[model samples]
Target: MPGRTRPIDKLAAAAAKCTKEGSVYGKCIMADYNNVHKDKCITEFLKLKECYLTAYKKR
Candidate 1:
């Protein structure tokens, strides 16, 4: 496992690849932080999730 990446590292890499989507999702949530409405950022969250999945698969 000399050159293998740890699971946490892979997760971080996938997250890094989806930073833009994550940021959008985060902003959407922060926009209504106190309100806590459901599905308000579903679109953004889905995009981030997809990006992370794709990135993780590619690794």
Candidate 2:
């Protein structure tokens, strides 16, 4: 596994690339952790998901 990239490493890289989106999504979730409802943060989550997908595809 010397030259092979680990799956976790790839994930970390993608997360780093999507930090802004992730932070926004995380904040939205934390804002209402007790009474979270469906689609409450769907917009933020979708943005984060798109960022991660784009980052992963670039690898």
Candidate 3:
């Protein structure tokens, strides 16, 4: 369950399973809300994608 788990699944389950796992899960509540589309992750990812698109357009 430690390092043996798949990285893809581990990342998806990170925010989803925090509550069932421990109290530190509470910390992610606001962060998770602030990032609604697909968690803080997808929001940040979209921002990066936008930047990449803009740069690519210049070239």
Candidate 4:
């Protein structure tokens, strides 16, 4: 049997997908840890938040 996926893991996967898709802001925000918290990555942050909430509710 497979273990349950963590919320953080889901968020990481989403971020990885976003990074691969790329954005007008460039890959810096998606690829760099420091930039993850910056304004440029606000959209990505929201995506992660949504994933977290969904995962939390599922648990």
- The true-versus-predicted C-alpha distance at residue 16 of model 3, in Å, is 32
Ranking by lDDT: 2, 1, 4, 3
lDDT of 2 by residue, 1-59 (tens): 89999999999999899988999999999998999999999999999999999999998
Q: Is candidate 2 or candidate 4 better by TM-score?
A: 2
lDDT of each: 0.91, 0.94, 0.47, 0.56
Looking at model 1, residue 25 earns an lDDT score of: 91
Count of residue pairs whose backbone atoms collide, per candidate: 0, 0, 0, 0
**Cα miss at 59, model 2 (Å)?**
2.0
**Candidate 3: 10-residue stretch with minimal lDDT:** 17-26
**Mind giving the per-residue lDDT tens digits that candidate 3 earns over 1-59?**
66586755544454343333333333444455655554445444454445544544443
Q: Over the stretch 1-59, how does candidate 1's per-residue lDDT look in tens digits?
A: 89888999999989999889998999999987998877888899999999999999996
Off by over 4 Å in 4: 1-38
Is 1 or 4 the stronger prediction by lDDT? Answer: 1
TM-score of model 4 (CA atoms): 0.38
**Tens digit per residue, CA lDDT, model 4, 19-58:** 4334533554647756455376767556655655555555
Per-residue lDDT of 59 in model 3:
35
Best-fitting candidate, scored by lDDT: 2
Q: Give the TM-score ranking, best first.
A: 2, 1, 4, 3
What C-alpha lDDT does candidate 1 achieve relative to the native structure? 0.91
